[model samples]
Target: MKIIIGSLNPTKVGAVKKVFNQYKVEGLNVPSNVSNQPLTDQETMQGAINRAYNARIAGESEIGIGLEGGVIIENDRLFLCNWGALVYENEVILASGAKILLPSEFINELRNGTELSVLMEQYTNEKDIRSKEGAVGVFTNGRITRTEIFEHICELLFGQYEFKKRKEENN
Candidate 1:
């Protein structure tokens, strides 16, 4: 089956291709325009929907993916929410990675209006914050690999799709 990932982003491309490869699904990466501003969780989800919906209108594909990030509050702490929206033709599938946990005190500081990227940069103090090919970035220092995190997101998406398919078959 043909799967169209909504963005030409290298990270997203790497993530999707890695996960879908195991399923034997042929995945395609299409160029998509993502907004510059960071999205809220709800807005992030909406962004995914927008991307997938637009992709469907653009052409025929078995699946489409939209990856987005947002900040969410829980127990007075702010967390980084990175997720992917997987659309299977007419059906919409949702999947999310585990939230990158933040310290409560730091979350409070961010809540006071500090950007997480800046905070992360200042905390590391090595510059090039997005670099995941090393011991920096969100998924480094032996914590998590970028590929593994994205794979989790993809797993949730495909797993949900499989669940639905099974449900439908049973009925």
Candidate 2:
């Protein structure tokens, strides 16, 4: 199986590779066609779906994977949200990963139009934070990494696909 990942970010690519180890995975840099900083769940999910569809079409692969990270405000608190999508043929499978409430410091910066990756870099004093541990890693103190988050999402997506396939076969 040939799988194309929408983003060249190491974490996103690594998650797809890890989840679908038997497949040939290619990471392509594709635009998500959404805002740099998605402020709602709907926008975040759309970004993932767009990337997955675009990558699959561009790579001419059997499957495409997209992972998007965004922030959402709930009850006057900001939370980090991540979404992933798997596109195959005309079907799309979606899943959401863990959500963590961001500290006021991060939220303040995010409200000022700073992207999460930028805020992470500033908070961790590290360059290219997205390629590394990412915001989840920083907040979780390495207990959970961005790759792990996306991996879980992929697992859920794959599970859903398998379940649907099996149901169809049974029917």
Candidate 3:
């Protein structure tokens, strides 16, 4: 099957490739049609959905996958969140990765319109940290990576897709 990933970021594309290893995967910089830095769960999911839909429409691929990472606030604390969406024909499968609570230092900066990605880069002194270890990696002391987060999301998405396809086949 042909799969189109709605991002050129190596981490995101690599995760999708790992999940759909048997298929032909193409990475493209499709528009998410949402905030550059989503600040809420709903917005982050919307970004993923938009990217998935746009990627599906951008080519003749059988599946389109989109992964988006952002920060969300719950109970006055900021947390790292990641969401993914898989689109197949008229069906869309969605899944999310585990959230890691961000430090209090990020709360004020985030509320002051500072993007998490920027903060992460500054905090780690590593450029393009989002495309590398990511905030999850730094917060977890490298226990979890951005690619791992997206990979897990892809696994969940693929599982749901397989079930849906089998259900349709049985029907």
TM-scores vs. true structure, each candidate:
0.69, 0.94, 0.96
Clashing residue pairs for model 2: none
Question: What's the ranking of the predictions by TM-score, best on top?
Answer: 3, 2, 1
* Candidate 3 segments whose C-alpha is farther than 4 A from its true place: none
The total of clashing pairs for model 2 equals 0
Q: List the residue pairs that clash in candidate 3.
A: none
Candidate 1 local lDDT, residue 112: 68
Give one digit per residue, the lDDT tens place, for model 2 in 1-171.
Answer: 899999999999999899888889999999999989988888899999999999999999999888999989777788889999999978999999989888766666776788988877777789997888888888899999989999999899889878988998999
User: What overall lDDT goes with each candidate model?
Assistant: 0.63, 0.89, 0.91
Whole-model lDDT for model 1 versus the true structure?
Answer: 0.63
Candidate number achieving the greatest TM-score relative to the actual structure: 3
Query: Residue-wise lDDT of candidate 3 within 26-137, one digit each (tens)?
Result: 9989999988888899999999998998888896688899999988988888889999999988888999999989987788888788888899889888899888988898
How high a TM-score does candidate 3 get?
A: 0.96
Runs in model 1 lying further than 4 Å from the true structure: 22-35, 73-76, 103-140
